[model samples]
Target chain A: MKLYGKFFLINLQSQMQYKVSFFLTIAGQFLASISTFLSLLFIFSRFPEIKGFTLNQVLLCFAVVQMAFSFAECFARGFDRFPSMISNGEFDRVMVRPRSAIFQIMAYKMEFARLGRFFQSLCMLIYAMIACGVFWSLSKLAVLFLMIICGSIIITGLFLVYAGLTFFTVEGLEFMNILTDGGREFGRYPFSVYGKEVLKFLTYVVPLALYQYYPLMYLLGKSDKILYGFLPPIGTLFILPCFAFWRFGLHRYKSTGS
Target chain B: MIEVSNLTKSFRVSTREAGFKNAVRALIKRKYEYIQALSGISFRIADGEMVGYIGPNGAGKSTTIKIMCGILTPDSGECEICGRIPWKERTRHVRDIGVVFGQRSQLWWDVPVIDSFELLRDIYKVEHSAYRKTLDELTQLLNLNRLLKTPTRNLSLGQRMRCEIAASLIHSPKVLFLDEPTIGLDAVSKIAVREFIKERNRNSGTTVILTTHDMQDIEALTERILLIGRGRILLDGNMRELKQRFSRHKKIAVAYAGSLSSDMLSNCDGITVREEKMGRALIVLDSNLLTVSEVIEMLSKTVDIKDISVEGVTAEEMVVELYKAYRI
Candidate 1:
């Protein structure tokens, strides 16, 4: 943890070298996410609700997924850019370090500009908290916190899988965007809004809905069972298999020619 | 100490012709060719020995270094460094070694050089006092006091390279692997780097394995040379002995006041006249077969000799000749 703090400070100092470029990237991130928010609003303007839930309920879902995604993008940008790291021979540097390769790679890059999207999601979360009409309770608040944290972990696991596959092939695997970016867009509505088949796939296969949908059901008082509120922690286990895949790929790692 | 035995590694490279149609075909069905990078190569180095690992391009010099540094796993054979198998105990093995790739910069491009050093200190878990002492010594030896404050991108290549050597030593590793450390430096920088490396090895007994195309680096820093070509160890011997073996033939240039016929020296065995002009002649002869005085006496008999000079083959010429002899 201490080393992580040092890495964080150094990365911040490096990013601050170009002050204008840093601020512009943050603004660009803010504007780009605003278009997604506006599109969601346009969908709600066409109908009073998506499926059986009101706009405020769907807004809560969108805000949670957005916050989790932005957090992952902010901290785990190294895994997202793993292809370039391997191609440019930076991975060889990582291997020679006395630290864990994962830790070194995580410290290699941090996209602080994604905090702009994080800030926008916080505003949406605040508005949904006021308008969504959920009864104030400590357990309900705890479930919301767990949903965001575990959702971020799940997405980071997906990034890990993406990075691991790069060990076999150096080219960018564009299809993985379906699970990472596509999950964010499709998650603007609760998983139930999609049909039963998609919900089952997300629940058992990828487990995106385990955090975003089930725990959310308990938060909104749709289900009184405390078990639903605890599903996000179970979703956190998704990282175990993702990490195993990463280790397997690491063993097969063939470093680029110097 | 380092031991490598029967190490072999191969890579499967995808192949495609350079055209849109071929590219589309490759996307559907690819062909791969296997390149044997290292084929049953083996060597050992004792503690505190400076050895030059030299080879032609794509001759597995970097491959051997990568394996020793714990970066790549060999397809077969074993490499043990300091009682640890590099690939098996990678984290532990890396703690005792430092690697520098000349074509790449390990320092953070946008931060001051000291920050990278400090981060490395933390990464290696060095004590604060130990880190400070090592940094002070390196800064003094490499003359890094001025370069430490500047960002890596802002510094000149030579200055950045000096800092790079210092950064790798912030942890004071037991073994240092330098791959092409002086690829494109000016004469002064090259000498400075070579001097520092020699000093470090002498003072701390740090084992150094250097790989380079520059024979000057080998001639200046290493006593033992390991030559690899076509994925095999072609020669392993002392630098002095190799120089002696290649330096048997010597060239002598003479300036005289009178004209001398080239045929006059041709009668003597093991002597060839390289060039002849109005008042000067260049002669090459086997030093083992004829003494310099004997040749000078014979030349003085024909023309009034004014001045004479003898030269031996240089290290560069010796290496080119070696490469040609090995047919690499």
Candidate 2:
């Protein structure tokens, strides 16, 4: 961990060398997500409610999922672009070092530019929270924060699985973007909005609903059941299989070039 | 200490033919070809032995190094480095070994050289005192004091090369594998690098296995040469023994004060006049048949010699001829 921190510090200092680019990308990340906010605005303007849920409540859902994705992509950029690392001989260096490959790869690169989308989505979320006018309790608030943090881990876990698959073949990486960028796109609305069959698939197959649908239902007062808030933590378990697959992929690695 | 037996590795490469149809068909139904990189290679190096691993291109030199360094696992082989299996116990096995690829730089490009060293110290979990001791030793030996403060990107190529060598030795590994360490280096830099390596090998008794195409490096540093061609060990013997065995012809360049008639030189036995058209008379005599002293005695009796020089065949020619002899 200490070595990883030092590497990250060095990388961060190097990245900060371009002050204008850093700040501009942060601003760009903010504006890019506004289009998603606008789409929600159009739908809510017509119906005023999405399946008995108000526009503000649905907007909050959109903001939380975007926030989770941007956070993971910001810190876990190493695994996000791991194919290039292997091709460029960085992974060989990682293997020879007397440290964990994952920790080193995490510190390989960081996409601080994603902070743009993070704050952009965050602004809409705050506006929606104010408009919803829900009185918050300590337990309800805990679940909301838990949902965001746990959702990031699940998403990062999926990225790890994607990176692990690179050990075999990197020819078909675009296929995985469906689960990553595509998941974030469709996740703008609550998983329940897609109906029971799709919701169950997200819950058991990919577990996107465990963090978004069930937890959002509890936070919105649609469910008085305290257990609804606990489903996000269960979603965190999805990382285990992702990690197991990574271990298997690592053993199968055959480095190329001199 | 390293040991290996019957090591093998092959790669599946996609084949492509020249045509638009083939290129389009490759996307739908790809044809793969297998290349046998290593074919039952076996060798054992005891501690403190500097072995030169030499070979032509695509002769499995890199594949052997990769397998030993735990980067690739062999198909059917037993390799033990200090009694530890490299691919199975990769982390533990690599802790005692250091590797240097001439083309790659392990140092961080933007950070100062010392900062990269510190990061390596943490990665290797070296004790503070030991790290300092080794750093000081390497700094003094490689003359890295001035370059340590400079970022790797700012340093000159020679300066960075010296620092790269230092970075590999910071942990005082037991074995070091150098892959073309002197490639593209200036004469002075190459000598300095060679001197530092010799110093390290002499003082620490670190087993060094260097792979290079420069015959001078093999002649200067290593005693045993393992020459591989076409994924097989073509020759494995001492440098001196190969020199004595395959050095078929001896060179004799004579500068005579008086020109002799061609009839007298043609009558001499066990001599081949390699160059008669040149200003100086040159003769090639079989070393196995006649001694240099006997040839000089015979020539001096008949021809008035002003100066004469004796030379032997270089290692490069001997290796080329050896490869040809085996039809590799």
Q: Which candidate is the best by lDDT?
A: 1
Candidate 1, residue B129: lDDT: 100
What would the per-residue lDDT of candidate 2 be over residues B23-58, giving only the tens digit for each residue? 999999999999999888888899998999988778
Root-mean-square deviation (CA) per prediction: 1.9, 2.8
Please provide, for model 1 over B200-308, each residue's C-alpha lDDT reduced to its tens digit, 9 standing for 90 to 100: 9999999999999999999999999999998889999999999899998888999999878788688779799999897888999998899888888888888999989
lDDT of 2 by residue, A164-241 (tens): 999988789998898888889988889888788998899999999989988888888888888989998899999999
Give interface RMSD for all predictions: 0.8, 1.4
Worst 10 residues of 2 chain A by lDDT: A8-17
Q: What local lDDT does model 2 show for residue B258?
A: 57
Candidate 1 residue-wise lDDT at A95: 93
**What lDDT would candidate 2 get against the real structure?**
0.86
lDDT of 1 by residue, A1-258 (tens): 899999999999999999999999998988888898899889889998878889899899999999999988888878987899989999999999988998988889999988889998999999998889998699899999999999999999999999999988876488898999899989999998889999999999999999899988888888888999899999989999999999999988888777
